[model samples]
Target: MTADDTVNQPSIALNSEVSAKCNEVVEEYRAGTASKVDAILRLQSIIPRSDDTEDQFKSALQSYVGMLDSADQARASAAKRGEQHDRSSSKRPRSPPESDDEDISEKPAKRSIDESRLPWVIDELLHPIELPPSLRLTRESLQLWSSNPKQYKASLTNAARCPEFPDSEWSNIIESKPINLDIVFAGHYSTSFDNRRTEKLGELELTFGETKPSKRIESAGDWLIAWTKASEALQFAFPHRERELREYGSYVTQLFGAVHPSRHHRVLQYEKAIRRRVSARRDLSLTDFSRFADLHLLHIDSSGAVALDEDSRPQARPNRGGDSRKRPGKGVEACRRWNEGRCPVDAARCRYTHICSTCRSREHTAEQCTNRARAN
Candidate 1:
């Protein structure tokens, strides 16, 4: 055959193979060996195409199967009539268009988007600018303004006459007394007084000695106002001593001292509890329970306690219970879990030696094995 004929022959063979597979699948479905849906899937797997084409293959397969059903019935009826009757016209199947319409109705149409208009669409983009924090005019600034009444009043009047001062702003300021003389001076004055001026004025000198009791009583009038001023000046003058001054004539110190111990204890206890919890969690995750399955410890010391496993090696452990040996001379076996004659000792000062059954490795006793060390 020519090359063209050979290619065509393969195509025909492929079509025949696909048809045979489809028939085998339909037979499986009819025999109750496989469901109709699974048969459709098996038929689709034999074809080389995407998932979208599977439905089309299923429709064609179903139409062919329906034709086979009709042919079987026609043959059965024809055999009974023999050649005496001809039912060719009556037996002819309907056109496939109706079946195609039924399949098309079962599948919904997919919608596609138009991408051409995407670039022309306008989107509103917002750029937000955060205003820097407005400078806070403190009581110090207002105090300065109050000290210089003329300057303070002039500044307020100028601000009120400015175009930026709206009617609402003016009314609110006027009603609420917004222009505090102290805060105005706070804004104008430097954080520190110039040392040059104080030195020049000879006001740098301070009288430290205490005056008479009568004079102390006399200064009470101005003292009240000075003491009642805001935290800024008091903090500046006294530094760390201000909080003590603020709590003057109150039980602040006594109260603090009274509850301080309990508070300290509570805080320490909470920290210890947290540490224990974290350690317990870590131990739980790292612990190998399987390794300790057969672990047993024998204790044979009186003054101290040690663990010994079947290996006969000693391992140190924390002391929870009191010493087992009542007298320093009395022999002791302190491992509560000790079984049979095996006894362990605290390796720190343990004198006697013993053996372990499970681990076979030997050193101090049954209580001292490394495996028991890890186990208990």
Candidate 2:
């Protein structure tokens, strides 16, 4: 109607336009086509054209951005928790058999090594060894050794002749003594022999004959022990077919239940053990043995610690002695006492060179120097 009213009318129209734009942004956000950042940007653009004061615009923008940030953090935390739960669930061991249907008997029989001659072989090998009465082989130990006769034979023969433990002492230890599972599974402890008992057990699925109904293992431990015996039998019977043995070992795990994925290394160890044993028995020429010895020494010098690579092969690490060059030099001062004969000090605690000042030799101090003695 008047000059002031005319100016206010356009301001009212601009505020309505800004309000409409704000509402459009809110709808776009709700529909999920636009993100919270886009919504905030849209809201900020509207603030410049709106009727609101500068302070009010600033306050509103800060509040909205803070709310959006809090919501985003909450979503991220929930997603992280869900991922962790999924990882743990995946790692949990498979549940035990739900019914008798899952029992070992229900599985289809597969062709395996024949161990019928195991008893005869074991008896023939061990009968001549004059073991102390205390160390007489039990049925269980005999069964375990039957798996790897070559290793067991080597171990038993060596144990019988071990000079460190006399027959009388061995007899005393084993007399009325229960069979040591450690000895049974590992054979006798020897610094020279690398025990592959655990690895041998893992390869049981590939090595031994079909699981007999009579020997249906009731527990996982017993099942593992039986497999160890089977692995040994397999090794003894087929020493040369390593590639086939490895493929069969992997296939066996797929067919039969495995111990655990974490323990899969045990199966790999068996392969290494077999290779080492096979290498030992195969008569190599002096030159070949020398080459192997050199390679082994190189492996030792390469690294102090042993580790497997991606291919499950042992990787010889490069020597880490280079790090020693970067270390700080010793800051010890010369010992004044070591230069005098009267100074009573131990070599380790005395940080200085013990050379005599008069003779410039380490054997005696200045006071005890032969030149000084002669001059006096």
Candidate 3:
């Protein structure tokens, strides 16, 4: 044979031998004995004249076994993960019964302070001064708004309002009308009477059980003035409840008052302002379609053997410029967006409409199939 013929003959024999040996190793690996590497080495050693052919074949076989073992381990791990997921899913908290009666039965009784005695206590404390109608509240507001009605009433009376006087000037006042027991007990007030004078009056009243006629009535002019200003400021803050304003005001009173007495008024004011601003603004919610479209804005690099078309192309060759356009390996080529034997953009416009090439039918390429795509 000529030199070229002899070279060609050896190449052909070598290719055939390699193919057969690869097949043998694969079969052995599948059988779980004599490992892929051993089988391949045994095949190569049969041709002793070939230098390190056994070693080369063993290396390749090892690589193949590694890939197969990795895949098998992944599958087993996935199955184990799925089993754990199922167990966790079954362990979720069961929802409680939904009916109002069921909810009521399940809940422990609330510790409610006696609201029946609230008004009377309030009246006694604020004696001789008629409570403003603003101090009165509906049953729902009363129960829901304050844990302690007496304290709630006092805070409401002290809330910031127009014409706020500093705490300095305050005193007792003569009766403008019959004293409201509610205002006396639960409300804040000041009296201008001296302790000695008050004691003398008390002693006289108690001893005689009657008042002498023509007794001089001492005036609490400064005290009355201070009380008037303070009361006005307090009352303005706690305005008479209209239905719409009641809920917001009551909520403010309950939460802020209970948690922060000194800052309660300021907090309520700020929170109300914020709510107003929010209400004035528009609301928007993005749908799934819009969200998906937004992802396309991200940058992507596509350097591969496959072109925009699914057809495989020859590996990229470097240009004269010396910049290499690397051809994607088999593993890398697995991650591209396609559908129904076409790209995403093309599939959307195609007459057949997009379908999973791998799962739905045999005609389309598996690479372009939606159903065959594995989630990362």
lDDT of 1 by residue, 213-295 (tens): 11110122222332233223323322443543354312222323443432322222222233233223312211232322222
Candidate 1 backbone overlaps, count: 29
Q: State every prediction's TM-score relative to the real structure.
A: 0.15, 0.19, 0.18
For each candidate in the order shown, give its overall lDDT on alpha carbons.
0.35, 0.42, 0.36
**lDDT: the better of candidates 1 and 2:** 2
Off by over 4 Å in 2: 1-27, 35-37, 48-52, 91-376
Give the Cα error of residue 167 in candidate 2, in Å: 95
Candidate 2 vs 3: which has more lDDT: 2
TM-score of 1: 0.15
Off by over 4 Å in 3: 1-9, 27-49, 52-55, 93-376
For the record, the alpha-carbon RMSD of candidate 1 to the native fold, in angstroms, is 38.0
lDDT of 2 by residue, 175-287 (tens): 21221222223222222332222225433623332111111122335335544543444333334433444554554345235435433333333323333433343232112
Worst 10 residues of 3 by lDDT: 210-219
